[model samples]
Target: MSTDTTLETPSETVSPILKSVNPATGEVIAEWPVHDADAVTAAVGRARVASAAWRELGFDGRKKALLRWVSYLVNHADELSELIRKENGKPLEDAYLELILAVEHTDWAAKHAKKHLSAKKVSPGMLLANFEAVIEERPVGVVGVIGPWNYPIYTPNGSIAYALAAGNAVVFKPSEFTTSIGNYYADAFAKANPELPSGIFSTVNGLGATGAALVASGVDKIAFTGSTATGKRIMAAAAERMTPLVLECGGKDAAIVADDADVNAAADGIAWSSFANSGQTCVGTERIYVVDELADQFVAAFKDKLKTVAPGSGDTATYGPMTMPSQVEVVRSHIADAIAKGGKAVVGGPESVRAPYIEPVVLIDVPEDSLAVTEETFGPTVTIKRVKNNDEAIALANASKYALASTVYSKSKGMEIARQLRVGMTSVNSVLGFAGVAALPFGGVGESGIGRIHGEQGLREFTRPHSIARQKFAIPGMELLSFSRKASTVKLIKQVIKLKHGRHT
Candidate 1:
């Protein structure tokens, strides 16, 4: 049974508190004061004040400060990993890996921001040949980030680090379940760079109301990560203020295996991708389509690999318990619906979804429209279906309304098959390879969410371009801007246009 405790309500306690509980043992790991709408507004105001000074630091200065903070994170990685383990119920190794990824992203953002965001010179059009045009990316002032709990450090840092590097101050509101980790990250950054203005990396802790308040707090822009339904609500709220937003919502990602693929490697990748981090990953494999000839072989290999997988808090455990207790019920409901609708459970079944932990569950021949297949299960559960050929597998993979991430395993035509899937990012022979390469943009199309959060595009997301056109020198015979110019100038312009472009048209 899950021992998770409900957060204290105003009527139940003298003061409202956001408690971070250990999902494995249901122990209260930490508590933070619940910030209300007014408090969130104040934090954004402070960030607005701090943004001026932060922007003044320029790219090099900000990069130095950010690198200092990264050094602190790397130095104290062990302590941070343990904290992640206790609060998120993920294994220590996975927690450490998350930290390493976060640090790498922070480093990348600091080093690459200047190159990507600096002003660039461009040629003026023929009609404005006397003018010099330049485009500069300017910070969007204060940015609000409402982050997710799963992979708390790595996921939120995707926004926080890039925003900071792009010269914007951030007001981050982590998921209610992972508030401590958020606060710790902010605190560490502040300690590493005491000279930075306060509120440059501020945080607001609370539940759903707090996030809504952040959306309504008049921040220059918002970056949110959560469910598609919640993302819609956020869009509605931000619409009132006409604020720009980047919504990184849920994903029903798929993996396609071709008949020509290496069966053993594909099976190993599928099993790991399906169950890693207890399958709570946004880009994790939830649905798989395998070509008919290799379906049985792949399934056998995947099941054989799953037999050694275990869920616990110990060192040797493959994965820990579910980070959110409520998620267990959702996983169970999806599996139950699939089975009731004639899906066959090849490995674990509905009985596997105990509180706190959901063991790996593999279902074969699941109905395409079933909840487990159609929706974001977000657990250690996956559905496998066999298709007639590669074309049918590609069609099935693109059938999801959400197209966040995908994987295609084929020796001869990996990239060819990957190009056919309509997803934001696809790994040819591996899972989530796009995320590790900081140069690639990461986000999705359709219901998966909007905007991106990595690479040059990610840095530019927190900024707006400011174009400047200066009249360097006036042309001797072309006074196009002045009505005082004679009709002869217009005739000459028409003749030049005819000579250059008329023939092509």
Candidate 2:
């Protein structure tokens, strides 16, 4: 991790501030005090103190409190949706969808945590037939969450809800671009449960230094969502204290269209998956592989659908602008590189990339090794490649280092093709279907991320397993090894063991 002290120091005469800007309009929406390293450490200390009482509340108490918080969010959904739209530059409908998922996960975590984490008895082996064994899941003190701007509400709640359900206090550090939304989330929960400790759910707003400080503040666990490079730096910083962390990083997801696929349905699903939220989604499809026999048909259908899709901040727009201004250049560079290397732009090209708002670009005939195909182009752009068969499509999809999410469209072999893709979750004949199902675990393999954040696995991620064993009684005639035992007893025991095992040997 970079230990550069260029950020605001404690002794500075003036405190710094973080400015939240609207990406679509390039206007400053709000300014917040930037919490420095000391502030973050203090927040963690407070949370640690509050965690004791939180754990004492037990499963039922915690569940009631979390549901109250969920009610608050539901009652004020409209106001929260508008704020999300302003901060993220996503369509209003998309913002509402994000809020809905956040609420669902919160409810799921509260309702299921006890059933999954409570103590359960296990049968003892024959050698220990008189013993009883049980296992219990315990909370891991305090947790620090460093969230991303994209899907601001839904993504972070994956950790926050589960951690709180497991009885751990949390100190959240949302992305600088969406700090206000983070404050809103923490404040709403505080208002819903006035009797709860202040640090039970807290927010610290700032840039990179604040996040780095949270990692080293001795939090029991850290849940992070962001780029792979940033995840690496966080992992290195947390290594000093050996703090366990769950990382939900980037993904260059792919979709495969089999020869027998429903071309119209596949096209519609591909368009939405590739361009929704201006292609800012971590699981968005960056690459498409279509069987050779249906490649032309799929492309034609996809282009026709793209004609109706427009990028804007209005309610009618199918998608909106890129939330981060810096991401525009990265998208432009990838598209330019692909075009410069013999790729053809079937719909839009490098020239269509405008700051904040990038018109959807569909590229075809791109080489398999191009940056657009090989890297995570987090923009409203996708590359379509023709494959000789389903096997070839599967091979191309698995070539990337990322394995977060994938999509496959086929009339008969959807499941078979989906099983071959090396990704954490796959949607057959659909895009991003696994995310809507609360029971499914979400996360990835390889560079995509480490650990899970939804369903039963997600709830357990915030807890540690504890096992207990007790002896019921001593068996009679089990003292053959004592000095007083007769030689005849030892011989009988050996003969019994031999009769049971000698035939197999």
Candidate 3:
């Protein structure tokens, strides 16, 4: 949930209110009270105080509370989805799809928290055979989550639900553009479980200043989803306090079309992955590298598919306008740059970038150094290049600074191609399929950001392990820990070391 202006704190502090504007019509949808540093501090303090009680509830107790919140979300999904359509400017069907993914992920986190976060016993080493070793997974207290706007519900819920299920209180600062949606999400948890403390799930609403304050608010852990640049700033700010961070950032995800691929199916899946939500998806397919053998058929099929996709404010439209206002210029510039270079637009061109709604723009044979191929174009645009072979296609796909996600559309060699991609998650024979599995960890490497926020990894992200060892009995003359140990003890240790580890190569 980031933009060029995201997380920018003003030098002169003033009461800056967030005026949520509908991107489709430039209408003022609603105004929200800004939360300053002091307000953010208070929210974190409250969450810190509630963390104790929340952790004391144990796994089963916490699971029940989480499920209750999920039910509330499921029941009021329509209302929430409607608001998402209005504020976020996504189509109603897309909004509903987002809600479904969010609730399903929340439910998975609730049901699986105990299995992933419970205390467990471990084997004692030979030297400590008389002792029992146990490891306890303890909550890291309060976590501050800075969410994204492109995925207002699903993305934040990835961190929020997992953190809550792992027995940590959460202080969430949603993207300022979707303040109401963020508040409505946090409020649902309170309404579902009246017995929980006020700070178990809370929100701090405002612009970039509010988010920056959350990082400096002394939270035990920070989970953020946005652009790579913003993530880097937060990483630096979080370092001062040695706070743990989970950053799910930007992606210039690529798709590889091998000679043995299903041309039509590959085109359809890539088209959806490229243009869905106006191509604002962090894991969206922004680049395509097709083998020369299949390049002509693939490009033709992709063009046919793009003809069915259009961006508009109408309900029946395939997709909606760009949620972030500043991103429009970024899209326009990328198109202009690609054209200025020797790239040819086969389907849509510069005229496609109409404000708010950017019609699908597909470029062929664009220079690899062009902005559309190098930087993250969070709009309805994709650059397709024909490579000599799979090796060349793989090389070009892995050249980007972003290593977030990618897709491979090879029928016979899907897995082979997918394994060669330099990304956190890769969908074989499909596009963006990794996101549908709640059990799969989601995040990235390099500029894509740090850490992960799903599956067992997500449950552990908000926790720290505490190890305990108890002695069952002590040998009278073999007390290794005693100061009065005999010289024979040293001789025995030397003999054991020679008989054990010393034998290994």
Candidate 4:
């Protein structure tokens, strides 16, 4: 939340330019234009007009363009990764992983859109027996996407790629912190398909106000990703126009380490889940439950591995500084609350000082009511609790307000435990596995927000279902609708209902 007045970028190259700052070293990387309300409105209007023709191009042509975009991303993998790393302060490796997910999504959506969205035959029912019925996906005009700063590429691409493949033009307003990366992706598409109008996929770089403009711009739909609080506001804005929206927001995901689990593997997984990208991920593990028997072993092993990662500048580093400084304060307060409530820091404490980066801290015996345990810490901190059995682990995990995603560590009981957890997606014996599998839907319920983002749900989120029913012939029982039914016809209807609906009596 710390805003540096140092101009984000030169105004000539791009108006309303954003300053790209490197969180790890407090250096301004670069700046690009900050688009205004009028510009964003124009972008959505352009998409609306462009979609009229784009939709007619049908599935095959759109798929070709998306596939070409994939090739563009793959050829410039290193370049894109660098752009992501510079704009958002994640490690280069993590940035590469994000790009990889984007590539996979592009290919998946292109290959599977027709299968998921194309017309499908359905039963016409007795009332309309003479008619045929089918369900098809229709492009919902213009789709406005407001992406988050974390995982800027993959998360936004989840909606963008799918919307494009479904034949809808997109107006993307990336988070102010990661506008440059968003611009880079949009510009690549413009280069790949010069015939596509400026609005087929446009990027407007600005703050919250610009996003609000898009929501108010009469776009057919809005796909947004960010904090749960902000998501509520977006939902309200979309409600103003009765616009349909898909919100993929925050989560307080948990991980369970059963007695049968491999302690080393669990420790390694927890380290990655909690500290990767400095714990900015929406599905990152915030709370961990271990069987009482293995509680001490996990704490010791986890601490040993965490000590190996030095948070600041180094060639051999596992994590970088937090992308946003305000998050550092939130992490600080959560740890303090845990300590005040009789929790012990097994590794580093608030006393441990570091500038932008915080030492990976592990809290033990934290009260379930404590903020660190109940809310999303979104930092390199995790609360470890001892559970008597798997049932207790499941209960504790489900007690949170957010039910986005979760992980399980066991050999035989992994799938069973995963099924018992109240989450949209679970990674059995791994962390964040469902997201890597493009076929599975990725989203949440309850406070974690509604709607799906990946897989078939992802493709359909941007499209409307268009059902077509054609009559083959008149029904033999036309008397039913004509009010001319006879006693024998009523008797026949009763007999058929009994035979079809009731058990053969």
Candidate 5:
């Protein structure tokens, strides 16, 4: 493990309460105190107070402040990316990309929040036309953002940046694995805007308990990114308070390689999609279904790419260690289970893991019922299955309980196959492509998760729509208020409905 210890310790430490344990070396990277419940409450309270003032600034003012933040992040990308790499054990290149994308999200949210969430004129039926109609999208007040370890900055900033730009105060609780990265952002943001209350962009340090508290802390909404099981818990807790939540959870995403695909390109995309970031992405492809006609050629090419690839520790590696140590066992069990059920490791086998770093494993003939194919083996593992054609490929890809993201590889049939996949976002001839497009919505269906982050969907997710209607004039009849409604009035209403919504002669 490379420990530069480059961060300057504050003269007045907040608390030596939280500790970052390196997944590769099992060494302590940094230590800080867990914020107490009182502290959390104080932060939330301050956010509530700050929100009033912040919201009063209007959309343009808030956009300028957030733009300044984006400028800061882009200018100091290296410093932020390094912090993320050290804390989360991801390659610096990947970290740098995540950092830059996060800044993009910030800029998008700041620029688009007003257009997406502002009041607009709405139609009112003739009966209610006396008053003018409008629909307003209002801020949800305080939003608690509990981010994930993988893509730490981008994932949570999807919510944090949106919430802030939408006139809502954010209380950010980053994953413990990447808390320092979160802290660095929070501190930098504070430095940039001292007038902004500490709570408006507060950072709470702790574990799951802190997150649970935030979910139940009377916040108007909660935005969470993590495992499906944990997402369920967060949803249930939020249910008690009737607070809305955006849950971005795990996915057993898959890719399909049709007979007409560029075999080498497909292989490259598959390897990167599955093993990049040590297979720690919610949208990462965990399975591949190839048409039997091209299965052999694809597998051979994929194995060739896999041969040159290796999981290692360092700042410059293609991928890094599993951010969470416990995930190692999950990966192992999945491999073991696949092998037990007639699966063959085309390249790497069960012995791929050596402490924190797990070499990429490519398996074939894995049964559909195997744990590796069904569960989220969030490590450097990919299971390949044979299919008859595009239909079979779609079926297998949709078979998993997760439907977050998918990739379809084919020259002519790529888009057709993508449309058939059940996943929320499908990349045609590309891997993780939707995330790079700021206009696309990112989320899942089924157990993979609900609610979208990024793009226009992201800006709308943190706001609530309020529709108002004004009556221009009364209907031709007085039947709307009186108990005795004339048959003519009923006929007129039916005619109006049909004229507005139905095809006319």
Candidate 6:
């Protein structure tokens, strides 16, 4: 899941700095002073003051600035990818892919924000035709963004880039785990446009108090990517002022393999989806529901595919160590519970819980109500269950509190099954495919979170609409809007309404 524990108010320590380390080797990478509420307030004040000038740039101007930043990122992909490998503990190739996706989304937002947020002349209806009507989109001033560490750049860009494209200043607070990456990103924007004001895109470094201060600070909106528990805490704090929020929280995504599916193809797709990036992906598949007919064959194929995948710091490693040390225990507890409850491990077991890395563990016939199946296991482990048919598979999959995203595999019924799954997004034949297409709006319903962060909807999320109505010409002796209206005018209007809208047919 794309979750950051920035809302937890931990006890004070001797040092007022955060140290960034390589999760694989425990090597120190960098450090930054923890910004408290007062520092956070100053940063938000800068963003608020710069917002006016940023909004005055207009669509074309903001688009140019955003594109320049994107170009800078593309040129520095290798450097950034290397940092991600060391700091966040992902393979170099996967880190590069994350950068590529982030660039695609940033570019998409810059190019399309104008088309989506621009003023439009809407239909005023027949009776109101005499008065011209228009709807114009306006930026919601300064926005406060609390980013996630999982996909540091790509996840937060869902808010930062789009907000800037829609003409608003942003004050971002990146997760303490990936502070360097976040600062590099915001610095690139300033480097690209030296003439622009600084606070248009800024960073605040710290943990809970910093994020908490940003929420409490007077900003137009708050965009957060984090855990459901922390998301609830943010809601409680936001309730003080009734602040608007866009939260993308935890997910226990499930993949359904149907009777008509190609066993080999489905196995390959979910293996990567389930274990890639050490299975830390928020939209990654953690649960699998296979038809009884294909259950055994699908299980064997998926297990074999996962055998080649291992976690390490080498160039050939499929993935790296778990980024957060605490998550290793979460994976272990879930596996223990699944085994104690009569589940069979098809791949690896308790021995897989290495300190820095956990090898892939594939379980079969785990209870649906168990922690492994019901909760978001942000690790390299997955559970496979046998279902009678598609009906049973869909029901079990939709039963989770998270309706974030799901995958369906069926040669003939792919689209049909996808349409029925209750989720914000579903991939018919592939896994996590919706993320690459920048035009798709990505968010979930229920406990998964609120609002979206991509495409035209993502652009509009940072703005509000204003309605303007103008009167063109007045008809003689027809004062319908004023008390001076004549009785003849009322009678004629009644006759017209009777003919136009009187019949049900």
Best prediction by lDDT: 6
Error of 4 at 46 (Å): 0.4
Query: CA RMSD for every model?
Result: 2.8, 3.2, 1.3, 3.8, 5.1, 1.5
Candidate 6 vs. true structure, TM-score:
0.98
Where's the lowest-lDDT run of ten residues in candidate 3? 1-10
Residue 126 shift from truth in candidate 4, angstroms: 3.5
True-structure lDDT of candidate 2 = 0.89
Better of 1 and 6 by TM-score: 6
After best superposition, candidate 6 residue 419: deviation in angstroms?
A: 0.8
Sorted on lDDT, best first, the list reads: 6, 3, 1, 2, 4, 5
Residue 363 of candidate 6: its Cα lDDT? 92
**lDDT score, candidate 2, position 485:** 69
lDDT, candidate 4, 47-108, per-residue tens: 88888878888889888888888888889989988878777877788889999998898899
Q: What is the TM-score of each candidate against the true structure?
A: 0.97, 0.94, 0.98, 0.93, 0.91, 0.98
2 or 6, which is superior by TM-score?
Answer: 6
Reference-based lDDT, each prediction: 0.89, 0.89, 0.89, 0.83, 0.83, 0.90
Question: For model 1, how does the per-residue alpha-carbon lDDT over 297-401 read when each residue is reduced to its tens digit?
Answer: 999999999999979989999999988878888899999999999999999998897788888999998999999988898899999999999999999889989
Q: What is candidate 6's CA lDDT for residue 448?
A: 89
Using TM-score, rank the candidates from best to worst: 3, 6, 1, 2, 4, 5
Candidate 6: lDDT of 282? Answer: 92
* Per-residue accuracy of model 2 over 234-333 as CA lDDT, tens digit each: 8888898999999988899999999899999999998999999888889889999999999889999999999988898887988878787778888999
Model 3: lDDT equals 0.89
lDDT of 6 by residue, 1-505 (tens): 6457647543333258889999999999998988877777889899988888899999999999999999999999999999988889999999999999999999999999889998999887877778889999999988999998889899999999999999999999998889999999999999999999889999998888888888998888999998888888888888888888899999999999998999999999999999999999999999999999999899889988987899999999999998888888999999999999999998999999998899999998798889999898899999999999999999999999998999999999999888888889999889988998999999988888999999999998999999999889887887688889899999998998999999867
What TM-score would candidate 4 get against the native? 0.93
Residue pairs in candidate 3 whose N, alpha carbon or C atoms collide under 3 angstroms = 1-148, 1-149
RMSD over all Cα atoms, model 5: 5.1
